[model samples]
Target: MGGDRDEGDSRMSNLTGLSDDLINAMNRHDLDGALRCYTEGAVYVSPVGVGEGRDEIASFLGAFLTAFPDVRWTPWSRVVVCGNVLITQWVITGTHHGPFSMPNGEIIEATGRCVNVRGCSLRTMDGDRIAVHCVFYDQLELYAQLGAELVLPRP
Candidate 1:
């Protein structure tokens, strides 16, 4: 998963033109381009946390782009679009090469481990811009790949 590659990130987004625009921007490592795909009041949700508004979205993306500068979310399923919702499954591949911050504000240092995490996203579109985006992924798998196991409290 850590191999030098683009994670097959060139497919058109299923949501709308905005979706494709953001994917293209991310593949090109253009944060500004990616951010332009969302509206000012967009809400980005993930298993890690929810980021409301463009500022919060940028901050959330900053963490990801910082942690995995070459990260890519490769589509693993046909995009499903109904009404204003666009859903797709993906294989998120990346290498931990910098500080990775958790949703709870815990920052993990670089481990250089590569992760091929299976995940999915549901994006709701308002007109051509994204209104809300939700992603699902396993945090435990991500942490374990970086060499840490969850310490569950015994009952």
Candidate 2:
């Protein structure tokens, strides 16, 4: 029983360590370093889009790097690790200095607005690498910070 508990703790520690490595990589804007934390066929899903593999994942994350060269993710609240999954609540702070693509396939030019948005993600680890990652955030909050107004269609 003690051995089993120890094993579980060890596994959680490893996953947390891997997650820290990923955050550090992102903070450094090291795309390759961040990619190393995932498996070749890892799937990343976010409000922005879904990336099925490393190349696609690169494009998905690279877009953020391009749009906010100074983007940084800081833990906004708690980080939970259970079994092989790690959940992180984080805050991203950056300036809109480059084009940002909207979910409607529209690209908004840089408005030079500073953005601080809260988000969360759950990453499932397969062995030491993340096999699946799901991210969540408020699109309206992000857009509002970029100075986009809500426009409703006429009924």
Candidate 3:
């Protein structure tokens, strides 16, 4: 039992390290470095949609960062690890300083809108590598604050 507990703690430490590395890579826009934190067959599911495998994940983030060059994530809480699962909470603060594409093929530039967003992620780890990551956030509030229409449903 003691050995198992030690192993779990070690795993948690590794996951925390990986999470920090990922955030650092994002801050530096080092997509390759970020990709190194995930397993080769890892999956990333963001608030927008799902991306399977490292290549797809990289491409998605690359385009996203290209559109939002100033995009940044600030972790407001420590990663909580349990067994093979890891949870992290963060606040993403960024300005619209570049082109952002709408779903209907509209491209808007530099709305100059600043966004303060609260979000969370769930990650499944295989050894020290992240195997699956899922992120959740409020897209409606983000869009509305960015000057988009408020399409919220009435209670």
lDDT of 3 by residue, 6-37 (tens): 98788778888889999899988899998998
The TM-score between candidate 1 and the true structure equals 0.83
Best by lDDT: 2
Encode model 2's per-residue lDDT on 86-115: one tens digit a residue: 898999999999888887778888899999
Which candidate gets the maximum TM-score versus the true structure? 2
Runs in model 2 lying further than 4 Å from the true structure:
78-82
Superposed Cα RMSD, model 2? 1.3
Give the residue spans of candidate 3 off by over 4 A: 79-81, 101-109, 150-155
Clashes of each: 0, 0, 0
What's the residue-level lDDT of 140 in candidate 2?
89
Weakest lDDT window of 10 consecutive positions for candidate 3: 100-109
Q: What's model 2's overall lDDT?
A: 0.90
Best-first order by lDDT: 2, 3, 1
Clashing pairs in 3: none
